[model samples]
Target: MIYFLRNVDDKITQTNFRKALTIGEISGNVLMDLSVMADEVIGPLLCNPENQKGWPKIVQNDMKRHVNELRNLMHQLKGEMSSQIMLPMPEGVENIYHAEARLKESDSEDVDLYLKTNIEGAIIKWAQQIYDLLQEDSYIAFKRTKFPLPISDIEFYTHRLRNLEGIYSQLRDPRVKRMAHYLESTRSVYLACFKSMLTNVVAALLREVCNLVIQQCTNSVDPMSIFQGDADEQLIKLRKAMGVLNHFIDTYEMNRDKVHTFFPPGVMPVRWSFDFDRVFMRFNTFMKRLKMIDNIVEATVEILKLEKVEFSGLRGKILSTECIKVLEEYTLIYQNLGNITYDPADPEDTRFLSDYDKHMAVLEDVDRRLASLFSQGLDECHDLEHFFKFFQIIGDLYHRPIIKNELKPKVAKLLDFMHSNLDAVKEIFDEEMAKLNPKGVERPMVDPYLPPYDMNRLNRAISWYNAIREGSHETEVALIEKEISAIDHLLGRGVEELTWNDDFTEWMAEVYAAINTLQERVLTAQNNVRRGLSNIAAWGDKPLHNRKDNPEKLELLAVNERHPRLVARRNKILQSHAEFLHILKDNYKLFFNIKEDEESDDEEEELEEVDESTMDEDERLARAQKLQAIMEQWEAKRIAREERERERAEIAQAKFERREARRLKREAKEAEKRERQARRDEG
Candidate 1:
């Protein structure tokens, strides 16, 4: 039963292959030696060598096949392969057991040393490899991706660790007891390190989520500025980041369990640097803030859903009050943003106002759009200033005031001016109509030339006037416009309506009036005849016609042609006609002929009478304006005449001077000569 190694077999552990036989020969010799020991372990107490179940067929009925079978099974015991499927490692286990049983003491010592060294070395090396693989990017943590299944990194790595634990089961043999104990202790240490490493990775991921939140709320690179990302996008990113942070906090216990229990073998839990409670509470503030703002934003969205709306109480313009109130609530939340803190000790303490301010800016933009819908007047029924012009048109149409309060005074003032100007012109027109005053006609002798007024201001006033009044004053306005039209028509006749002339057409107006009433005697005679005809019984009878009205009273009417009263009336009519013809002849001359001699005297005496200052303030100003214009013309002509005379006189005297002028020149020359002489002497 004892197996001994010879000199050449010792060459198997030699430095040079020259001392050893060929590889096949050496393998056969080693297998023969190993089979003898296998036979000893299998004798009487164990199975027959030929019937050993796991032995290779060559080893059945031949003791050499036992070692060959064990060695053959070792082919699958390569490091990773051993980990891949660790069940039924019979070759390795039996080899360890058989080595201690039947070999010589020195040879057995050699086998013990070889198995212990190789098996222990392999176990430690594989454990290190597993740890090293976990350090690699892909294997260190289970990859999170949007793939077939949402496999969590913790579960994935935990499953892999459980599979790796299978390798430990195969090492529990007496021959490798020391190796097993060493591996067990090493595995425990590695699992502890792995747990620590895993916890660090999760913590890193938690920190990454926190960084995302910081980027959302505050500036990452800067300490002061808040992030300015888009409002809708910011809201989305914040929600997702908050979810990730919460997930880490929620599964903290489960992750530690995975590291410790059979779930992931001998992994141990490690605490993070900062307290979990503090971290949770700190980030929860952001959630609280988000919840508060969420309500405001939702309300605002509902209110802004309307394409058009109207309300008041906004300063300087009109807009929707309900929507503004919602926006104000949002603003109030932002203004009083509390529980936000920064840590100088922690560079990651970047939860600032940029994200919230950015969303607030988005809200401000909405406000600006809404503001564009406001209008100052009824005519401003559009909000093209805002980008959403078409959307705001309906709001503009409903919200604009009929006339803004500030603009009222300007319109009223200018309208009053126009009204006054019209009245002044009307008064002058009426004065011109009174063409037949017995003393003298009060004809308006206004100057033809006048100063200009501010046409731009007037035109603006007119436009504003029309914009304020919504077409309902037409009846009253039209009645008043007749006077304006009359004045305008007269002015179109070239200011002549305001000027007087010596021509008799205006004076002839009185003659024409007289001609209209020249038959005054006809009314008197008709009245006298009616009285005489009243006494029907005092008249002689005349032929009566039944159809005639009051036939019995017809005698007075029929005899009126031949009666004494009728004869007197006829004679009086002839006398009145002759007198009327004589008067017409005289008036005709006065009407057509100019009284040239009295024109200057008459105009001078009636100058004050012609002034229509008593009519109104506007008329007084008009008259004064006329006088000022005449005075300017007179002053201009006087200055021009004086300039002409001076020019002519200067031409005549250009080469000549009088005695006084010649003496003054001589004295001026003498004074200059004396002054120069005095200065030269002093020098």
Candidate 2:
């Protein structure tokens, strides 16, 4: 009967009958049969019945085995529903079992009740123990890494809960049923707590690892300083830190299944996410610093290349000592800087590079300026003055330390050119002087009238020499001074040597003295001639006066009659003046070789003719007046002679008449006395 009941319970639990029956009905109908069988059949048989013969040992043992089996089946069913449902028999079933128990009011009935209550108590205790174990396993799995509970542990707990569910379906007790449902609810809550604990553990571990990596990266030395020392050492430290991070990742991958058992798919904890961003950001920063160092090194190498660079012109050929020194200093600076693998990112280093570039540009500009200074030659200049000024300016520029080397040779060439020009000028001076005085004889003084033409040429040469000397002096160049002084000495010697001849000076003095004396005599003669002409003119205008009383006028006429002596005195004075003019013309001709033109001589003769004609007219008038005076005087003399002759004849005629009258008177007396002596005589 117990086997039958066990089979019936298994069938009811496996089937869907619990959906159709109420908890009270299931308890009453299903579980009451076990109690009835124990009280009516098995209990009386085991206590020894009266109407039947006494059982054998085998039959008694069989009845006891059935009773024990019934008790065990009731215990398992009670444990399934003790906390879930209240246990009660059907309305008449309990009374039927109680009447059966009364009929068998022996020790057997008491024994059955004791066993049923003991099994129910044992079922409730086991269920509570299993629930407590689940809680403990979940806590151990979450809190400790060492000896953590495996997934099988959770599986074992889930298997026990399923068995309990099956038992609860068969049980007729409300208390046991309530206990099963409560354990099921507790199991769900513990599972949720276990999943949450796992997520927290993983997230906390990730946070700790990320924090360590962040600390390592942040605590490293400055990025620029890394280039100053051993760069590999710093890189190794970074690699080690990265290795630690990689190990953590590997560990996570290895245990991915264990973590996923608690956490759902695609659900990562939020706490450790920022650490990943920090790690990547630090890595990028480190890479950028490395690139900066590379760029700085490249620029340094480029700067070092400048030591071998060559300029394109004369500046390259002539290297000044100062420029060489500057280059050496630059090389030293580059070496000092090149030894270190400095950080290009450093602002101070960047500034140094910039300054170096600028200095190099300045050097190149200086080179070009020096090259330009030597490109043109001195001969290209317009004149000596222009060339001198240009040379001075360029010389001053080249005299600087950066451009001073190799300058002396150029200056020497210029001096040689000046010497040649000076020699040429000196030769010209000597040739011109030779033209003036070929014999180079000594003289007393320079002739005033016959000044040498060579002097004018010498003046022009001196002007040229002085211009060059003055320009050279302004430059203050020592090289040109010696030549200038030599030229100056030559000029002085030429001036001092120029002189006139002694004989020529004396002859000119004598000639001048003679001309002065002749001028005085000529002036005196001219005054006397004018006075004589005036007296002759007065004599022609005046009437005749008494000869005896005007004896002074008559004396003037005698003086005027001496015209031949006045004319001879005038001609001598004029001839002396003409000789003085001829001497002057000869002196002019000797110096300048000038000849008088015939046309000019003719014009002079015409002017002389007009002057002589004026003088002749005056002289002729005076002579004509003198001749008229003389004629008037001669006429008076002739008239006086004629008058005296007429008077004598009259005297003779009167005497003869008087004598004849006397004769006639006497003839009257005597011829009248001789008849009148013939008349007187004839009469």
Candidate 3:
């Protein structure tokens, strides 16, 4: 019952013309014949099949059908290879019809072999060409780090790798024989190589891009230099770098089609032998490197934030203290006077004293305090300049958000401190005046014997009693002046020296300079700190400050008209030179070149583009020639002007030399005359 010697009878039975041949029987015959061949030829000829000497009609028919199927399968595989490998598109897809037509022309049984070899070779060649194109495009696109979605493009390439699996399936089919298998094996080898190459290229591109950005951001510390006059050079360097980067990115985009033309397969087979956990661990490490870079940028911004607040707070405190001291001292002079008339015997009167006593006792205390405070503040504020500049660099690297929560309390505390000191000084002055003069006397009737102004001694005593009274309001100069004048009339109109020997004018100069410096420093610190705080606040997942709209600062327009607390400071600096404000203003312009918005002049009319069809060759040539002539003339004029300027400068130098020579001659003549006079006197 066992089937034996099965070649003749089995082949006839498996034939579609006689017995109803099942797919299994046909497959069995192909494999049995495959086992009979020599081992080397078995694999190669089955893969290629051109070496087969003879074939049954059924096998020949089966080979023909397999050939067509392979042609279709290989085409699909080629597409997958192109896309997965990111290979360049070939000029035209190979036509299956032409391949089949060539196959039919040959009557030889090796026709299948011939067709498979040619098709397989063509597909491999096409894949390689596409891969080369992809490499070229990648090299150009290497500079374009931000390619909308390079990962997505890579994923597309991966998808093609997945489709390429179909070609592998066709190669493994028993019916394809050795020749077809050879083509499939070649494709498999190439796919393995391409997958590895692509993975490397993608990793390299990512690492290179990330590293470049990190280096650019990390090394950029001196932002102030950007605003300096030397910015042009740095700007040029940056622009060049950006242009180079842009060029690479443009190349990447332009060549993307060519790279994707091969539609290479996705789903590269992971090596079965490799450890999954180890691969994942390496991946995690790479991810952490990116995150660490971000954290470093954040930490830098925080450092800047701390520096801004610390320096600003210190500077603000010093300024507020100095301003209050000066104001209190200036108010004291008037408050010390009991009344307008100064009487020597009157207990409340201080006006009878000369400049030495009045200024020394009353104003010296205020002046000295302010000067000391100013000196200390100036030194401290100067020291902080370096710190602020250091932090400014950190601010530029990380755009720190301004958080209002941190700044509100600090600004409020500063304002409150200034107001409290001012109130305290005023209250003290009022209290001192109240104690000096007490009101206890009844109203006095006008008497003929008394002097018209209240110079009477008894009247002075009564006035003093009335002047030394307590009141809620501040003791101003007008109130104290009257009391002093009354005392002076009572005693005699003689002046005596006062103990207050204060150089107020000099003290004021110091106070003003200190306040100005302090205010400027505080304001700068506030700006930098606020900028950082706002950046932080904005960066958070949730906001901490009030988001509702508030009224705009309408009163800012009147800031210029507000009281001048630091005018004396500016005046002190400018006192030695006329137009000091102008000089400072000019110098400020030179140091800080603030750009102003200006209206662009549009006087020139736009020239209409000439129509090429309307213009003759002669006319175009003439226009071009004229333009060249004009450019030449303009260049010549520029050169001539430069020469003339040089000549004029030489002439001016010669004139200056002549004037100096004349002055020297006149000086010599004067010396000779003096010598003659001395000789005459001696004779």
Candidate 4:
């Protein structure tokens, strides 16, 4: 009955076949609808015959066959609709089978279109399904395919096309042959576009990587500047670029066999040709550059070591200006090189962990050289003048940590030495004064009077201190004052068991006060002596009767009677005064010339001396005039000496006052700064 139905369907007239075509299309739709219902509802119902025993086996079988026939008709109708060729037919014929038969008698265009619509449509549909499977997830193409799957999309499509070609080979239809050709050509075009896009993307990434490598080589400074961020940033960027290139290579390698096939013969030797090898080659180049930088740093450190050796002999020797300049230049270069940080874990870094010591040695050398220069400066210092110059040089290098740490203690030691010498000198002066004055003898309280012993003692002490003060620079003086102030602060902490040596500030202050007291006493003594001389001259001019009634005058006359004990006391006073003046002349030559002026005048006066009895009258008068002129010259010299002493004393007093004022002001400023700092810390 199915064969009879097929014959009737094929033999239908044009009008009748047209009606049959409409009915067939409607019937195919109805069967499709039923096939869905059967799977969703009817098949489940039939699974248990007891549930729907009304439907017999024959009835179910017939319905299944009808569904299959309807599916075949739908496939045929799809092929006919896709055809661009109009299949020739007899007049008024509408049957699709007859139209197809007429089309078989046509030329290649019609044959080609008919075969493409009929067979190639199915091939295209199958190729599209494979394409969709390969691109299931856009981000991960074909990554989750089953075992034995095609390696890439193009390969998978090629395999499916081969199977379709084999199936169509059995048919003699030229249309089927053309459809196979069309499908193969379309697959080739699709694969070409895909490979081109992949190549472009890979080429662009390679270019970017190459550019980054160039930038790393050209723009980066030496490794020393890496710590400042420039070289390090460039290296990090290079590393990231390398990472991207590595990822692309990994992706390409995964599908290498399939994707590489897209390239025509003789175009690429293999998948690992220019594209793959170039990336790794550039990576190797970057690694070599990094190693080169490491070597450069190591060599720089070695050069610095050589410089250190050259300056090593300069230790303990007096530093000339040229020596200082050389040391300064070496230190600056060492500092610039010392800033480099090495990473031992990096493959390209040739600097091993053990080599870090070599780098540190360079830094140590800088410290050693600076410290040696400071030590040499100190060793060469002898007097206050030299000490001031040395201290200024040290101050210039004070900004270096090594100089501050190493040289400050040396400076402190020098100060201790000076302080000890000062104490010894002061002690000698005191002992001499004690010897001159008897055990129980008190200093006289009379106005404007200084004992001869006290004057001699003061003269020695003043000369010593004045020499020190005159030789020192102002800044050195200030440094001494700062040290003294620090000692005072420590003592003020109220620590009871302090050593005398630690109380240097107090000792220095006491010594200064003594000198000031002696200066005042000297001035007072000068005034008192001048007043006494004036009184004696006035008394000597008065009449004897006027002086005889005055008890004060009688006492003064007895004291000046040239009695033996009074005469001895007067001679002792004169001897002590002469000895004190001699000490001033010897020790304080920078300030005094008393002995020199006296000796010169005395020699000149002796030359002018002559006896009046041994010469004529005219020669005797000339000799008297010469003697008067010599006495006047002596008087003039004595007056100039006194004026010079007075001027020196005044200048010393003014200098002391200015130094004291500055010290007080500096102390006040320091206290205020400390207070502000404390307040800020509290807040």
Estimated TM-score per prediction? 0.21, 0.15, 0.17, 0.18
Between prediction 1 and prediction 3, the one with superior TM-score is: 1
Tens digits of per-residue lDDT, candidate 3, 184-203, equal: 44343344443343343344
Identify the leading candidate in terms of TM-score.
1
Task: Give the per-residue Cα lDDT of candidate 2 at 619.
Answer: 79
Model 4 lDDT tens row, 601-653: 54664653556578998887877787788779878888987998899899778
Per residue, candidate 1 scores C-alpha lDDT tens digits across 1-683 of 33333436554655755455443223444445444444455343244543667977655434533443454344334333434533222224456545544343444333444444445445444445445544544343334454524346545544545544443344334444543433333343334343343344334445445545654553322222112333444445545555764676567657645544444545554434544544445456555554535533442433344434443233324445544555566545544443335422134344434555565565555544444433332123222232134224333222223312323343344455567668988997887767646687454454556322223543443343343234323643343354335334433432332223223232233223332222222233334444444433233233332232464665434443346556655565566556556555444333333244333323332225664634798888877787888677666666866886899799547523442454566577779999999999999
Instruction: List where candidate 3 sits over 4 angstroms from the true fold.
Output: 1-257, 260-288, 301-310, 313-398, 401-683
Worst 10 residues of 3 by lDDT: 595-604
The local lDDT score (0 to 100) that residue 634 gets in candidate 1 is: 63
Name the lDDT value of residue 591 in candidate 2.
24
- lDDT, candidates in the order shown: 0.44, 0.45, 0.41, 0.49
lDDT of 4: 0.49
Residue 189 miss distance in model 3 (angstroms): 25
Arrange candidates, best lDDT first.
4, 2, 1, 3
Top candidate when judged by lDDT against the true structure: 4
TM-score for candidate 2: 0.15
Assess candidate 2 and give its lDDT: 0.45
- Higher-scoring candidate on TM-score, 2 or 3: 3
Q: Write the per-residue lDDT of candidate 2 for residues 1-683, one digit (tens) a residue.
A: 22222323344554655553444322444566665666676656664545235777677556555565565556556645543221222212223344334435653333333323333444444445434433443444455455655775565445444444443343425543333333233343333332333333344335344544544544564443533444345555545554665676667556653654666678863332223433344433443444444443333333333344333333443433333444565556534543445543333344435534554555455544444443333334434454565455454445444444534444555666687789998897776666675466643344587853334444444454544445433433243455446445544533443234222232233333433333333333334445545644444344333233354665534454356646655565566556546544553332232335422332331111234355677776876676677667556656765776799799768746754654565455544545445664454
